[model samples]
Target: MTVQTSFESRSPATGEFLARHRVDSSVAVDAAVRRARVAADWWAGLGFTDRRRRLLRWKHVLVRELDGIAELMHQETGKPVDDARLELVLAVDHLDWAAKHAGQVLGLRRVPSGLLGFNLAASVRYLPFGVVGVIGPWNYPVFTPMGSIGYALAAGNAVVFKPSEFATGVGVRLVETFAEAVHEQPALQAVTGFGDTGAALCRSAVDKIGFTGSTATGKRVMAACAQSLTPVLIEAGGKDAAIVAADADLGAAAEAIAFGAMGNAGQTCVGIERAYVVDAVFDRFIERVAAIADRIRVGAEPQAQLGPITMPAQVSVIRRHIEDAIARGGRAVVGGPESVRPPFVHPVVLVDVPEDSEAITEETFGPVLVVNRVRTLDEAVDRANSSRYGLGSAVFAGRRTATALAHRLHAGMTSVNGVQSFATVPSLPFGGTRESGFGRIHGADGLREFARPQAIARQRFRSPANLLSFARTARDMRVPMLLTRSLHKRG
Candidate 1:
């Protein structure tokens, strides 16, 4: 295949051109990784304190240019400015949390010496993995990738980011802003291009790759990384569900489900794609959700609650899912297939969608929701967990029931009485399980994801019963055998 040399980004809301970016070749990607390796050594040598200071400086720089950065995000992704700003705010908050907590999370700590090695002292510390390659998605160009970039940098690893072609401008601007803060070295850099550019990064010598995109693209990334035996952290597609129990606050559940499913034109990875409401309250819940979803305006205007679909190809996918649901005896309570306009899809609330339909089974990543009625709360939980993609989920019920239902959901993260709330808390680990992809990108687990743990052992003094010594005779081992038997024989 002929690799495209360069690509131009245009506003998704309009056909207007935004900016053009050079597609980095394999050689360019290698050079960038080589630079990152050198920078990683220096960055790691800075220790936790210095790295924290530098990362905080970068956060400050991001805050200073918040408006400009958000504007660029809006132009490229066609998301509302306020939503763009909120994305930045979450990214910045994760950065601050990662910077401030890296030491405590990855710092050296003493470990207990087992009974078999009573004379030995042991300690463990998580050390950086030199370099990390990040492939970001356009839907959340800033916040989603920052979940990896910020935590990796905090853990003392140099990062070479490969952002989505649709959001090239925002990616480049992010790297440029980082240079402004950490001028001493290229610890954080971005390579812009299409799929081939990202593939090049995956095949490069980076210690690990952090990828966030569709499940299909994530599989491609894993395949490329497999050639080099490099590790990967994937945050892929999610057909997340929301369970509304009979006791749930119908108004609150409706509002959250509407916003969760339709926000950002329904481009969110962890957004609600399916909803299961108990049969007793299904009618009332559907009525409220349809009402709210109908009032949500979609446009490029500042006052609009939702913006245009950032990716042009997704418009057809959205239309297909809606049509499939309707064909399978589902009713469009709010908007029908006709609501799908190029670069814009109105909120679609589907009721009685077949369990096997595309809208319920696949990741219908548009402003569409499949709401189904369940005979009981247990049935709701079972239906919710039936999807192959279990990234995130929500449970709307009373405190006791919500907690119970949340725990029953087979997902990496779950929010009780709220939607997408797990993502806003910087201290919580993010990512998904099963086909939604593995590995975390926030909190302590996020820091450790970019680093390797090193265990150290030192002999405080020699023991007379040295079990590891070859010079010991059979009689010398008798005491240890008896002690071991006495200690563990009961268990």
Candidate 2:
């Protein structure tokens, strides 16, 4: 049976439904992909410069209408308008960078041919994957999904986007703008529905799928994509950690930990869910962070520093983590289960939590963070890498030592002394390995993700091995084969 987008999307701050629509069926998904194929051909045929021009025009729309878009995002998400703009600002910057750099990074390049193929010329080029399916999350809806959509378009692939059911209005607006930028075809289209719509995309004949959601859902998506041997990139959930060393900048650490933990009401996949503070600064650091958390308020009002929890199901997850930690000998240094006030979830600063507690080891996916004291940097690193997730991390230490510690963490990207800044830097690749998901989604790696590598070789002449063809060449084979073995062997 097919599902409908009948569920109401409510504002987290006010608990009011925003908008709703009907879900797309397998039939609709197939039609979308078919349309995308034709669009892909047109999008691909355009020179990189022309494609970039179109993208820039689309970006201009976003810039000119920034205030309107930001307000819509804020009303729909319950996040402050300022915070909503943060998502757009970083997103526009990435769009700009991708447009300017796609040709230089993704154009054809020469491949070296060994001496064995001296008479042949070889080169490699990136070919579009035809159509790509992007299943995006509701948090930072525009910025997150655009990471896949924009890059796929720049790489010459048409995108069929299935945004989170909760953000169908935003998704529709995005597609409307995309159509405006390219009047000839539907380069980007939306299929608004629930998991069934996403599953339909997974089962369809699309060339690749890019998904961003929880780890459990990611596993299911991977299994579904495996049925078609379709490549997938899953920017799944994370239990990202921040390490506060004795030599760290305490003020900066406090700011990073607080925002990394509480931003988007802690709805982000790469948000900081755990913190390891050096025993030396544990007391003072905790006090400073707690003060910051206390000043924060969660409501629909524009003055609040933070907002209410966006996903209703996430409320239960946050409660479970806090209760589990408290039952497992952990204490809530600041806020606890009582902090979750339905529509508006206040920031919870958990301290004295066990390193193995669910609060520390699991993804609360809320405005909650667990702070544990460690004696050494070794202990901090060990605790940070203990979880099954390894998406993103942060290290607050000396420049040299921070880089060293970041390398040791089992994550894809690390911010040396900042929070969420790595995701803003389009120059670096994004995404994770292991349970966090495989593959990348930003930078040159992102452009290549929606494309397949094609290698071409041109032969100038026949090889010496042709001498052994119909003639009496037993002796010739012996000489050539012997020479091949001798040349291959290390003296």
Candidate 3:
């Protein structure tokens, strides 16, 4: 296939041309990696304190230009300015946490040499992987990619980011701001294009690749990286669910679930896609959720609560899911198939949907919710855990019961009595298992994800036995054998 040399970025809401970006070819991608490798050496040479200082300076720049960056994000992604600001706030917070904690998390640490190797001193430290190629998603142009970009930079690796074609402008802006903050080198750079460009990046010489997108696309990335046996950290699609137990606070649960499903036009990967409510309170809970869904406003107006679907292709998927649910005998309590308008889908609440239906099984990636009635909390947990994607989940119940229920769900992160709250905590690791993709992008795990653990051993003194030398005798073996028996023998 002939790769396009350039692409246009247009507003999802109005189709207004935003900017044109040059597509980086495989050769251009390789050049970027080479530059990043050079920058990585300089970045890694700076000790933890100096690196921290530079990162903090970049953070402050982001803070000062928050409004401008959020505006750009709004134009590029069709999200409300306020929502864009929230994304920036969370991204900045993660950046701060990663920068401030990288040393404590990845710094050198001593380990006991053990009895047999007492004369040797051993230590381990996480070293930067040189360069990392990041493939960001358009759904969250800033926040999602920053989760990887920020932590990778903190861990001392230079980054070459490939922002989704739909959000290329935002990505370019980010790289420009980083240059403004750290003018000495191109430690953070962006290469823009479509799937070919991302594939080019995956096949590059970067030590690692961090990707966030659909599971199908993630698989493609893995395949490309496999050519070079390069490592990858994938944050893929999610069909997250929320479980509402009998003892839950119905109003709070309803509000959170509604927002979780409808927010971002339901473009969020970890957003609530399914809700399983116990039979005892199923009717009341559905009514409450329907009420909240009815109040949600989705449009380009300033008063609107949700913005247009950033990617136009997703609109059909949302409509199809709603149509499939209704065709499968599901009832739409809030908005039905007619509620789906190109570029904007009003909140939809589907009930009585069959568990095997596409609406319940696949990721709709729109402002739609499927609520099902379960006979018991155990059944609710079982049904929720049956999905292939296990990215995030929520449990709404009494404190003690919620904690127990949260632990039972098969997901990477669970928010008890809340929705998508685990991502707000900077110290908590974020990522999912199974089809949702592997590896983490936040907290200590995120720092280590972009680095390599290097072990060091030094000979403090020579052992009298000289067990490793050719001069060692049978008597030396006998002494070690006797010592092992005395130290390790037990009842």
Candidate 1 stretches greater than 4 Å from native: 1-3
TM-score of 1: 0.99
lDDT of 3 by residue, 318-395 (tens): 999999989989999999999988878999999999999989999999999999999999999999999999999999
* lDDT values for all models: 0.93, 0.87, 0.93
lDDT of 2 by residue, 302-359 (tens): 7987877777888988999999888988887778889988877889888788777778
Span of 10 residues, lowest total lDDT, candidate 2: 2-11
Over 234-324, each residue of candidate 1 has an lDDT whose tens digit, in order, gives: 9999999999988989999999999899998899999999999998999999889999998998888889888898888899899999999
Which residue pairs of candidate 2 clash?
Answer: 5-23
Residue pairs with backbone overlap in model 1:
none
Best by TM-score: 1
What would you estimate as the lDDT of candidate 3?
0.93
- Model 3 worst lDDT window (10 residues): 2-11
Q: What is the lDDT of candidate 1?
A: 0.93
Winner on TM-score between 1 and 3 is: 1
Model 2 TM-score, 2 decimals: 0.95
TM-score of each: 0.99, 0.95, 0.97
Task: Tell me how far the alpha carbon of residue 293 in candidate 3 is from the true structure, in angstroms, after superposition.
Answer: 0.3
Better of 2 and 3 by TM-score: 3
